[model samples]
Target: MKAKVYVTLKKGVLDPQGKAVANALETMGYKEVKGLRIGKFIEIELDGASQKDGEKRVKEMCEKLLANTVVEDYRIEIV
Candidate 1:
């Protein structure tokens, strides 16, 4: 099975990297972008009996190591 995890900074967390990118874009003439936030997407392959199992394992992975629950939120998808 294949799993994808998306990890993102929680609302109200300061993302200096994102801010810097946004500022650079604005300077390059992309003023339409009012805000920006950076996030991570991780893909993993596993031998799961079913999609449900894959999702369960991926969620656990995110909660345990892939993402910091105190500062980040995550979503898991199995394919």
Candidate 2:
């Protein structure tokens, strides 16, 4: 099974890295972009997990290590 996790800063949280990238984009002449938020993308492989099991485990992984629950939100998809 393959899982994809997206970990992103919660709305209203400051993302300096995102801001820096946005600024760089403008400097590079991509002026249409006015906002940006940077986030983590992770892909994991599991040998024997069912879809339900994969979802449960991936959610736990995000809550425990992949994301900061206080300031970040996460989503998991199993394929």
Stretches > 4 Å off in candidate 2:
none
TM-score of each: 0.95, 0.95
* Residue 6's lDDT in candidate 2: 93
Q: CA RMSD for every model? A: 0.8, 0.7
Candidate 1 lDDT tens digits, 1-79: 7888899999999999999999999999999989999999999988846888778778888989999999999988888
Q: Which residue pairs collide in model 2, if any? A: none
* C-alpha RMSD between model 2 and the true structure: 0.7
- lDDT tens string, model 2, 40-70? 9999988888899879988988989999999
Displacement of the residue 25 alpha carbon in candidate 1, Å: 0.1
